[model samples]
Target: MGKPTGFIEYLREAPTEREPGDRIRDWNEFHNPMPEERLRTQAARCMDCGIPFCHTGMLVSGMASGCPINNLIPEWNDLVYRGLWREALDRLHKTNNFPEFTGRVCPAPCEGSCVLGINNPPVTIKNIEYSIIEKGWEEGWITPKPPAHRTGKKVAIVGSGPAGLAAADQLNRAGHWVTVFERADRPGGLLMYGIPNMKLDKEKIVRRRLDLLEAEGIEFICNTEIGKDLPAEALLKDYDAVLLCTGATKPRDLPIEGRNLNGIHFAMEFLTGNTRAVLDKQPGKDYISAAGKDVVIIGGGDTGTDCVGTSIRHGCKSLVQLEIMPKPPQERAANNPWPEWPKVYKMDYGQEEAAAMFGADPRTYLTTTTKFEGDENGNVKAIHITQVEWTKNDNGQFIPQPIPGTEKVLPAQLVLLAMGFLGPEQPLLDSLGIERDSRSNIKAAHGQFTTSIPGVFAAGDCRRGQSLIVWAINEGRGAARECDRYLMGSTDLP
Candidate 1:
């Protein structure tokens, strides 16, 4: 430990963000960088606890409790505290192939399990991680280091999202020829489209990494769907190994009345279109505009929050986010103890922007949509909703019960369904003849990452369902290790 009593002397501090009122005017990253000295002080807050649960990377109460990739947190924190910026970056890259992505978007489960968080605030781990990697880039410490030796093995990775990219980076470093296939016009499948430009700049952040990967000899084939553009059988025959990292992209739909109405869109459709328009520097005719319209977003999570932010930026007349579940407590509940992810209420970047514009949080908890009301043009005009209470069903499972006399209608010219994904689209899996679990995720063991078919592997959301980007990287690295072992009969990837 660099500073044995550092945690006792210093309090935790986080990076400042751009003011909500100012940041919503345009699409740009809201977080302001912390000074190097302050970041060092923050790093010093990492306690010398014998058991650093922050890097344990275990599941507690069915939720991620720590860094899924098992980042060497203490080592990096110590290095950063001692002003070893370059060394810190080296330690960070040892485990995480893409710290920039995770540092920006990951929920920071490691902080949740921080020993310092048991009583006081947690260390600003996420921000420090962001700073370390950005420092690496600025210092010219990060550049393409192509493999010294070639394995002469060709690998095909389907989907260029976080998982696929991580796997490609690992296999390429292992001296294998890796080719990543993406159906989108560009690479970075989810990072390029699913997230807004403000949170993660596609051209600046994502494309920069993609370009670096290419410089390292990995090939990216865009606008190419394997099952459609090219037969799935070709991958198995042409490549020495095939890894499936296609994400769980099938959005859960609300099948209520008037679902066929125009202006009612899936969250991804709205997000993906908006991102494409932003990149193209012009909104297409099909762009779902919230301008001058009362927007109603059904469901709540990162996706729902993004809808709120995007709608506000479009100058929506009003915004209301409906969440069927009750609001979480302000603090950890009785059942949620230390090291478990605290189920507490907090404002995200989107809600902050919404509050600044609308003078409220925008989320209406414990509310369920009954039906979508449409006008003569078959365009959605309003939403019928009702309050609900959690009641035990015959199976002893808690279910939302609609409360009597709580029915209401909210005026809405635009509706976005931001409910989470169900599972991976099954067409590709079917074409490849890969088996799926009950949840429709590709059936593959966690550590082995091997599917029922030989030379075929699965990882990330396609195998584990919708999850944090960090977990996807974890699985991707694991899958790559196993794939390398399969290829060379031994593996050095860690």
Candidate 2:
């Protein structure tokens, strides 16, 4: 350890976020970075515990409680503590392929599984990580280092999200010719479009990384859909190995009354258009305006939070977020003790902004929408909902039971369904003749990314179903290693 008593000498502190009122006016990143000296002190707080569970990257109570990419947290913490930033970035890149993306968006399960978190708050590992990569960029230390030699083996990665990018990056570094096909207008499947511009500045972060990867000899083909524009078989005939990282994008929908109303839209439709408008400097027809209207968002996860923040930016008159499950406790429950990915309540930026403007939190827990009430023009006017309670069915599975007499209605000119994704879309999978699991995810073992088809592999959400960005990166790297082995009869990727 750099300092045996470092943990005792420093208190956990995070970078301050820009005031909600001011930040909501524009779509930009809100967190103001902490001073260099203070950040160093924060880095010094890493005790570098003997076990170091922070990098274990294992499932605890069925939730990821640590860094899934297994970042060299302690090594970088000590490096930052000693002012070896360039070295710290190198250590970080040893495991994680994209610290910048994860630094800004990841929920930091590493902190939850920190050994020190058993009693005291965990070290500011995420903040330290953010600082390391940012400093590397500011100093022009990050540069494209194309492979010294070519393996002449070609690999095609169908998807340019985190997972595909990571796999492409690794395989290219191993001297293989790599090509990434993106169905969107740009590379970065979700990073370029799905995420809000404010939370993650697209041009500054996502495109910057893409540019570097391009200069490093990775080929990117945009506006190409594998199953539509071109046949899936084209990939198999062209490349020595084919890896699929197409994310789980089939959104789960609520097929209820008035579903075809004009104001009701999928969360991606609303979010993607807003980001496109921001980038194009003009709103398009696809953009759904929440301005001067009451907005109701269904689902309480990150997508719902993004909708809240975006609606606030659009000057929505009022907002309400619905969650079918009950509110999580303010602290961990008895069954969810230390080191188990604590199930607790914490306000995200969107809710904080909603509270600031609307005078109360927007989330309503234990609720279900029964039907939609719409105006004669086919625009949704309101939604009928009922309070619900969870009870175990005869099979011992908990289900939401509607409580009668608790039915009510709320005004909503716009409704966005932020419900989670089901799995990868089926067209491409079926076209390629790849088998699927019971859940409809590509049938492939976890570490082995090979699908039912020979010389074809899968990774990320397509292989494992919908999941966090960190986990996607993990699968990508692992899949790359296995694919390299399959190609050359040996491998050396991590």
Candidate 3:
């Protein structure tokens, strides 16, 4: 530890954000970089606990309690405090392959399990992490170091999301030729389009890493679908091993009346189009304009919040977000212990911007959309919503029951359904004759990552369900270790 008593001496401080009203007009990131001295002080707040739980990366009460990738948080914190930045970046890269991405958008669970957070605010871990990696880039220290020798073995990865990229990086480091296949025009499956520009800059961060990967002898084939464009059998015949990292993208739908209305759309359909327009600097037919329209977004998750932010950028007239679950307590409840993931109210960036623009939070909890009402010509005009109560029924199962006389109609010209995904689309899995679990996710053991068939593996959201980017990287690295072991009868990858 740089300073044993630094935690007691300094208070936690984070980077400043641009005012919501000012940032909404542009698509650039909102965060302003913190001064170096203050960032060091923030890192000095790391307590260096005897048993640091921040790096545990385990699930507590079915919710993430620490860094999923098990980032070496304490080592980097001490390194930054001592002005040893290059060393700090090395410590960060030891566990996390992409600190920049996780630092920007990941909800930091490591801070939740911080030892100091039992009383005072936790250290500004995420901000410090972002600072370390960005500094590495500025100093020209982060560059490609290709493997020394080739093992004469090749691996085929399906999907170019975080999981696929991590696995590809690891396999390449082990001297194996790696190729990634992406269906989209871009290499980053979700990072390129699923997320908006303001949260993560595409050209600055995403493309920079892709270029490095290419320089390191990794091949990426864009606009190529494994099952549809290229048959799954091709990879089995061409490559020595195949690892499936295709994400779970099958969106859950609300099968109610007027679902086929012209104005109603899935959240991804709206988000993906908006990002394409921003990057290409031109609007196409697929672009859905929220300009001068009342928008109603169902499912109050990150996707819905993204819709809210995107709509505000498009100059929406009014907006509201609907959630079926009851609002969480503003503070941690009694049952939520110190190390458990606290279920508390949080105002994300999109909600903060909406509150600043509309003078109120846009989320309406405990409310569900019953049906969508459309006007003539099949354009959605309004939505039927009802308040509900969660109660234990006779069979001791929790169910949502609609409260009588709680129905109301809200005017909405554009309806975006942001409910979460169910599982991975089955076309590719079925074509390959891969087995799946009861949830329809590809069947693969957690640590082993081996599928039912030999020489084929699965990882990330395709194996598990929809999860965080950190978890995707973790699974990707784990799968690579197992795959390398199977191919050479022994492995050096971690």
User: Which candidate achieves the best lDDT against the true structure?
Assistant: 1
Model 1 steric clash pairs: none
Q: Stretches of candidate 1 above 4 Å error?
A: none
10 residues in a row with least lDDT, candidate 1? 281-290
Query: Candidate 3 — worst ten consecutive residues by lDDT sum?
Result: 277-286
Q: Per-residue lDDT tens digits of candidate 1, residues 1-494? A: 78888899998888899999999899888878999999988998888888999999999989999999999999999999999999999999999999989889999999999999999999888999999999998999999999999999999999999999999999999999999999999999889999998999899899989999999999999999999999999999999999999999999999999999998999989988898989999997657888999999998899999999899888999999999999999999999999999889999999999999989899999999999999999999999999999999999999999999999999999999999999999999998789999999999999999998999999999999999999999999999999999999999999
Candidate 2, residues 1-494: lDDT per residue as tens digits?
67779899888898899999999999889978889899888888888688888998999888998889999899999988888989999999999999998998898999999989888988888888988999999999999999999999999999999999999999999999999999987899888888898888998999899999999999999999999997999999999999999999999999999999889989999998999899888998888889999999999999999999999999999999999988999877899977788778989999999999998889999999999999999989999999999999999999999999999999999999999999999999989888999999999998898899988999999889889999999999999999999998999898
lDDT of 3 by residue, 405-439 (tens): 99999999999999999999999999999989999
Per-candidate TM equals 0.99, 0.99, 0.99
Write down the lDDT that model 3 would get. Answer: 0.93
Relative to the true structure, how large is the alpha-carbon lDDT of every model?
0.94, 0.92, 0.93
Q: Candidate 2: misplaced stretches above 4 Å?
A: none
Model 2 clash pairs are: none
Arranged by lDDT, best first = 1, 3, 2
Deviation (Å) of 9 in candidate 2: 2.2
